[model samples]
Target: MRRASGSGAVAVAAVLGDGARYEAGRTQQTVRAGQRITVSGHGCTVRQICAYRVVLEPAAEPDKAAAAAAPSSPRPVGGEADGGFCFTTNPTVLATASKGFPPRGDTLSVLDNGGVRRFPAGLSITVSYVDTRTRTARLRGDCAAVAVADYDNARVGDTVEFAGVLFTVSGLTERAIRLKRTST
Candidate 1:
């Protein structure tokens, strides 16, 4: 589960014992605070929604068999062991602020101006800019120039497709923008 940063929403991605997957664009639903959302076959109540995280209370005990079958950690992608990407506010400075720091166990790679990094698939993301408000960021497709109107209102937790790949706005701050590769 991940909070929507500025938005008071949380994205819950879960899989059930029956192999039913729940995530953004699939079984996506909006529920009020204190409401319960059932993902696949599991139910949980939204206890609190904060600036950085969402608190949830499980409605029932987990199925031991299903829990055992679940992977201990998410599989890595793009040859990244942590499966996350970080971009800092100061393109000239590297990882100077906590907000711009990469996730624990993740490596940092500073991209030069006009530089492009290719992932395992055809997905390639270029940082358009990190918002000064610290609440949003814009991603360009293959380092191409994108119009401001194209992504002016994109919020955290929003998913956008570029080429054939899907990327999720995972985290945002004044110093950094974090994106997670969803699919290709």
Candidate 2:
């Protein structure tokens, strides 16, 4: 089946890696990873702008054959990332790091796999705390940052170094912070 207009996972892959960019008409653009660039679409040509940011949606890779896999459910709209990145209907979701922030004062939250993944990359925030396994971050620390990054980016089960933190996402209408884990 054909996807709406020109939206396809392959089209997203067509612009993979940094330095590669594509403009899809006047409403859409694709920019590769690891580079600050904007892929904007004109009437028929997509323009690449320097020093701008582009975000790519992540497609879920199935663990088994498509026929064997269960039909997936729709992700929550405007939700945050807990297990992984969230999918957004709007493609302009991304965050740019303003500076290398210290983990101190850093805030964290979990997205229940609804709206997006890794906060879309262009969000900004203040460092509340950081460790190899977990990040302690506050929502108000940065607004755009909350919208751009995800804690599931956290990696666990490392013998030595780890970054993914243990936390829960709260405050749906406002800033959500880490709910302290009560000892059993």
Candidate 3:
């Protein structure tokens, strides 16, 4: 074992046997395993960190004590997707339900969960609707990207729920839907 030291604001002073004095900033580090080192430098008032490795004996029977001591995986949070909605929470659902919507990095929790789920900053919609004239309703294909106007097949006065928000389709095109928010 060896002694290590670090400094905050005051410099470390060492006195020699002959009454000589040496003053310098003190910082400590572990250059290698089982060895600690301290170096003196100018204005080095930073915190000291050290790393070491521990070795445990191999278990005689793998399941005897290991299962009791092993930690179980943590439970999923409310927003975690496990065989449920792709975007579980209201805010996440809202952020992902619309195309051309900016992503707030500060609000994102899970960075990646395998497949692609990002959209460009354009008005895209996956609309399933019943034609008012013919009264026909069908589900759109998954990953079906289309303009807002095409959602209801150019129906001028139709509404759809996206991310739990209702939007009245006011105008349309092959790739864009002009929507009027009717409710919060």
Candidate 3 lDDT over 59-150, as tens digits, reads 23432244223122222222222112221232433343443332322111111112222332222234344344543232221222321121
| Model 1 misplaced regions, further than 4 Å | 1-25, 63-184
Given candidate 2, what's the lDDT at residue 53? 18
TM-score of 1: 0.33
Mark the regions of model 3 whose C-alpha exceeds 4 Å error after superposition. 1-124, 127-154
| Model 2 local distance difference test score | 0.24
Error of 3 at 127 (Å): 6.9
Q: Order the candidate numbers by lDDT, best to worst.
A: 1, 3, 2
Local accuracy of candidate 2 as per-residue lDDT tens digits, 1-184:
0011111112331232221124343333244344343322111122222221123322223311221222233232233431121222222221111122224334334332132223222223332323323432222122221222222222221110001122222222122333222111
Task: Judging by TM-score, tell me the better candidate of 1 and 2.
Answer: 1
Model 1 over residues 1-184: C-alpha lDDT tens digits? 2223334344443211212134344455555568877754678777764333344556775432332232233222433322122111122221222223334434333232333444422234455556656566555432112211123234567754333234456665555555565652
**Model 2 segments more than 4 A misplaced:** 1-105, 115-154, 157-184
Count of steric clashes across candidates, in order: 0, 45, 9
Query: Which run of 10 residues does model 2 get worst, by summed lDDT?
Result: 1-10
Q: Evaluated with lDDT, which candidate comes out highest?
A: 1
TM-score between candidate 3 and the true structure: 0.26
Error of 3 at 119 (Å): 5.1
Residue 34, candidate 3: Cα error in Å is 71
Clashing pairs in 1: none
Q: Per-model C-alpha lDDT, please? A: 0.40, 0.24, 0.29
